[model samples]
Target chain A: MEKTVIDAHNISKIYNPETIPVYAVNNVHLHLLEGEFTALVGPSGSGKTTLLNLIGGLDKPNEGNIYINGTDITKLSAGKLIDFRLHNIGFVFQSFNLIPVLTAKENAEFIMLLQGIKKSEREKRLQQLFKEIGLEDKTDIRPSQLSGGQQQRVAVARALASRPHFILADEPTANLDSVSASNLLDLMEKLNREENMTFLFSTHDQRVIERARRVITLVDGRIASDSAAVPTSIPHEQVVT
Target chain B: MILLMAWRNIWRNKARSIVIMLSVAIGLFAGIGVLALYKGMMKSRIRAVIDSEAGHLQIHHPDFKKDNHPAFILPDANALLKKVQSFPAVKMAVPRTLAQGMLVTTTGSAGVQINGVVPALEYSASQLKRKIIAGEGFHEGKKNEIVIGKKLADKMKLKLGAKLVLTFTDTADNLVSSAFRVAGIYQSGNAPFDELNVYVSLTTLNEWLLTGNSFHQIAVILKNDDDLQVMQDQLKKTYPSLLVQSWKDLSPETELMVKTVDEYSYIIMIIILVALAFGILNTMLMSILERTKEIGMMVALGTAKAKVFLLVLMETVFLTIAGTPIGFLAAYIVIGYYQKHGLDLSGMGKDMMASFGFETTIYPSFPSEKLVMILAMVICTALLSCLLPALKALRLQPVEALRR
Candidate 1:
């Protein structure tokens, strides 16, 4: 009973506007099934993050279209696209973009604030999320007061605050240590199973890719391979298509 | 929540926010201080003229604005005085005869303009009784008595109860003479009002000026100074041919000068407001520039660009609200203290002010309208200067911002 939540066709993106263009994403096609834990991986300049940006409605593709949950985001008006991104696509970034002035709870409640959700409901939801994320004690503290890993955890909570259908993480673990990265992957894997949330990410770290049910590899702005991953990690063997 | 966030954000940048508030407060204090001082002082000077020297309105032989003539007179003083008394705002109406004359004694003779008034009625409408430095105001229902300026009394070698002779052109321009006991001497602070003016009984002046009980124009006092225009308009409507002069028109040059100076002050106020607006704009713009990355994140987090714009605008409006009340209080305090005392210009500018007919000490006074106008200027400039910051916040590209 798998449903396709995202479909990409012939999506090509160019960073350079010149005649001799640099392709950030080229001739890439992807479809993420409902309730799937998918990871995208490649080296630097390999277009993994570019592919995620195109799918997440943060950027436009130069030569193709992207559909999220069956609606073409490319056709949505700017305001409606923002609403779409707010409700259906959650994003976690490498830098953990928490507002320095706001507390962890406020950051977690940001999407609900944008949705015009009532404050009581937003607060209640934040309390539940804070409890689950092991950040109940840190909820009232500003991001500047928190460590890098704690800030990233707050970012993850905020991304999930709106109950989005898909969560996009770009190098979410790059700034974390080995233990922190493992803990974040476990949290994502649990959310992917219990809440039936779809997860897509771009990373070079094996800790993240190891938790994915499916992996998409990008090479030179093109998709090199798309395949399912073994549930258990083979510590001795490198993952290859 | 948005308002709360805006409030918290302002406190987070306390230094910048405080600087903006201080600028607005200073501007408002100066503007309001000037307004109060001008209004209070002007009222005092004008009231002095009305109660003591000039009645609220004047009626003169039409040609008197041109020159004095023994022949120029009102046809019937009793009848016109009755018509004037019918008006409710006329606190007390009186007939006065005026002529160019000379007061002579053994020691000296000096040129004078004699005002002949019914003394009892003049008492009810004037501060003359209080200003008398020697002797007393004209006796009630009596004759052969006169009051002269303090300076004039000295020149004529006259003392209280000293008999003085007055000579003037009679109805036919013939020189005639009369006599009076020196009654009182008064000073109105102006050398011109003090030195050359005289008051005598209306009956005696009628006999001296000689036009068979036909009197000069009737003067009036109104209950409220503000009612001058309304009363004048009503009086004009009631008697179209009767010439009426309100105090403003009676002192047209003084009125014109007050308005001119007020206009100049208003122009200066506008320039200060413009400068303050620019200062606010620069501060807000700098803050926006510093928060660019944060604003970009808000946009990338699926915040509507319109909301981004609104959030920035709300931050500015919130700051202004927080500051403006404090500014208003500061302005009120400064103006209130100065308005209670007065600005003493006596050291250097007193002589110049006296030459220009302003008092030695200038005090600030103004109506509520001026205060409201200044408040509006401060608030509008602060809020308006926030436009550039709001626009900058709105024009973000989510993808590029996320990348940054």
Candidate 2:
């Protein structure tokens, strides 16, 4: 049986709670298992990103307990949460936010450096990750020298280099061309299948949804539907290109 | 890696960074140059006070300095001179017979302080011979010869080789007058001293006063100024009845000038550095504000607040330190050149400088301690300048920062 990597019970996030009381994430319960490939889908203002932020420990929920690897992240102090994130989670943003002054290899090695990894081990992991991402020839170049597609690939390589328990990719393909988006999805799927690395994404792209094994839909700050099995709403043939 | 990032970040906006760096450089250059100039000027004035006007130490009959009375001459002038010259620290001691008198020329008359000195001893002790811009000093065996200052000679319409009458009261309370030939005209770069003083032979003045071998003052020059206080104290103890005073006590204005210059030099440097620090603070704040998104991303990617703060601090320090060497090197070159050739202030009018007893030509001197202090101040200002910007970076929340 797969272990539950993330478990949330009745988490709520309220904005202007003193007066207006608008709920960004309302009374949501969620659980993520290891090795699971999931996509969070929703319309605009449906609180998908807020839920992702809460679950990733980047934000705190107004009311609830969120456990990551059986440790309650919501109860942790801000500093401790940051340390926890460094050790247990990786993030991939849509804008491909690699440090501009650093080369690709240095960007990939940043998290490991923060974790106090030795240079040799960091180099070893960087070599393997660059090989997996097919950026071996491009590792010495800064992000400005690379195309948008290549930059996103380096971002993915950076996300996976630390061997975190899970990767949170927020709209990771939103800025890419169709060919680059398909290539990135293929790379992420391959990493999921081979390394059993759990993946979670908050995205509006139909391509991402079609590739995900499980899909959870949010509406009006609450989960409207969850498909634990392979998604069937989008036809497989239409997204296979 | 953080240091590398900091170094690269400063170059992100080359123009802005360069402006701040140049400001630091220029401020330091000005501060250091002004300090060196003031140091040189003060040193020259102090040297004049010690070597020309007053020797390192002076001994007088306690009542003589009170009124320049010829009756209050040293009781044992010859014995006191022999003993003072025997001290190891004393380079040479010369005796002078001082009198408040009047100098009358055919054209005009002026009040004067007459300094009656031995020809050879006074020449060596005060270097009054070097100050003679015209004519010659009193030669040996030249009787009734006097050396008047340029100002006094001009005022009384007197010239070298011209005869003048000096009138003063004798020790026996009788008015006495003597005629003396002016043999030399000198300028000591001290306007008031030049205008009010005239030197004649000690023996001639003593003969005219009918006082045998009596003198009012013994001026002592030391080989090393470090021995001044100790020698003064010894002389004071040995001759408890006489008045022994150092040059500083005799010339309070020169003492005040030295103290004021030392204090003002550091105050000026601090003002310049504080202005530079504010420039740095403004530039760093703008840089941090422009990089809001980048900082937010770093924080979101699990960078600790301390690391973020450090990055900002390192960037500011690098920028400031980059300019320090340039300022120091430029100051060194300019001051070195001026020290060799001198910086002439003749354009500001020589008479004005002479009035304050300073030479028109000044040589700038840079002490190593000033360099160390300026560098220390620069570093302190740099560190202080970075705090506000670093804290501003730390206050940024990752989510909101990313939204920008």
Candidate 3:
């Protein structure tokens, strides 16, 4: 009964459409309600990342539409779409894409700065997020100075800074060791439960999939399965390969 | 924050940035130093011509310039000289009798332009008194005394105190001749001028020619050369029937040289700036290429394309702003030192410079206004150099760039 935060209707993306056409995302219909922690899982080249990109307005879909909080972002101009993404959606890349020149606090506060958030409010939110991510003492450290796990924690803090409707993380745990991966998932789950923060991840890691409340499996640019899962009941050996 | 990112990014590749900055500085230094030296040479040439030959302004009977005939003479020449010297801007004025004649000696004979001058007035009006390299200057009450150039003396084989005869037509169109003793030998450092000119006392020339105090030309020097045009205009108004001319009119070649040096400086500046622009472009492009992922990530996080373009531009501006002042300061120190102790071109181009009426020692000078102009040009070059790289940053697609 929670309000639907994302509504995607029959969207398709075709790559190399002029010659030897490849359909990267084909006629996918999906929706997520508020507070849903969802995972899009598929093997390599199965269109998991493509679907996430289309939903986040990072890539354009060739047909149909994607709606975030009932706004059709597929109809927006490139410039407007960037602004929309800034205010409405957060993104975490697999490579822990923090601007290497900026300190952790500056990186976290960057989106809010783009959104023209006042400095005092940005400071308040940045401080709270850093403490929540256990990186309070690492605020002045640049990405290069931080460990991989600490860097990813700062990336998560950046994503949460603007308090967007949802965050789309693409293979967020791909570069982390098991302990770092576990810690990141735990942090994300904690933010999801306590803050009702909606998240949609394109991941093949079993650790991530087991933590998601909803799992949508993709095969050959189409949804092969959509199911609900109990986090503790999902088997570790059943990770998408 | 964007500025901070741009500033920090320049230092990320310290060695590369420093190399580019140094290239810009060196190019600018070379361009400015060469321009200053050329300007100094032109200035020195102009000063030499104005001081030794043409005064700041000249007044002549309209018909006298048409031919060397002695009939065309300024009426009341003494009154005109006194009136010209009364002006506050007029530092000195002197009247001269000019004749194109032949100098004859026992050993040789050659053509010459005879200038009749009063010793004290001529000394104040021209630097000829200072240029006497051998023998003393004219003596008071000495009749038929002459000052001739060393080159002329050498050609005629006449030494100081040697007797020579000058032959020319008088005002009545009757041929006349006079004997004079060379009392002084001068070397004006100008080969052509020194080769064909001699001076005699105005009183002696007047007595011999029976021209009775009439003058062919009146030369006036100003306390400040900037008043040349104003004084020329005033003289023209005062003597409407007389032909009044400034140094620019009397010596068109020196004026042309000034303009040509200005134009050549601009051309050289453009060439240097173009070279510097290439260096800036290469550095900026490399910086942008290496930060492709970072730029992509910024755009994906909702930084506007304009912001990305500005970021690259800011980095380029910072590099130029840091380098330009250093270049200008270094040039200032070098040119200042040379301006105090002249840069000697005697070993390099003494004959060439002397032929062109320039001194062997040049004082390099840079005008403050020109310094401002060069700084503005450097900043403009930086802006122009950043365009292509900034456009490249604008063309980046967040999706594709992130993948790269």
lDDT to native, each model? 0.78, 0.88, 0.87
Candidate number that wins on TM-score, 1 or 2: 2
Best by lDDT: 2
Candidate 2 residues A1-241, lDDT tens each? 4577777778899999899998989988777778999999999899988888888888899997787777789999888888888888888888999899899998988888888899999989999999998899999999999888889989988888777889988889999999999999999999999998999899999999999998999998898888975332322222222
- Candidate 1 C-alpha error for residue B118, in Å: 4.7
Where does candidate 2 chain A have its weakest 10-residue lDDT segment? A232-241
Q: What is the Cα-based lDDT of residue B304 in candidate 2?
A: 89
Candidate 2 lDDT by residue in tens digits, B290-342: 99988987877788888999999999999999998888888889999999999
Tell me the DockQ of each model, to 2 decimals. 0.50, 0.54, 0.73
Query: Model 3: iRMSD?
Result: 0.7
The residue pairs in collision within model 1 are: B36-B364, B36-B365, B37-B363, B37-B364, B37-B365, B38-B364, B38-B365, B39-B365, B40-B365
Candidate 1, residue B130: lDDT = 75
| DockQ top scorer | 3
- On a 0 to 1 DockQ scale, where is model 2? 0.54
Task: Estimate the overall C-alpha local distance difference test score of candidate 2.
Answer: 0.88
The reply for model 3, stretches above 4 Å from the true place, is A228-241, B105-110, B151-163
Q: What is the lDDT of residue B259 in candidate 3?
A: 92
Given candidate 3, what's the lDDT at residue B15?
93
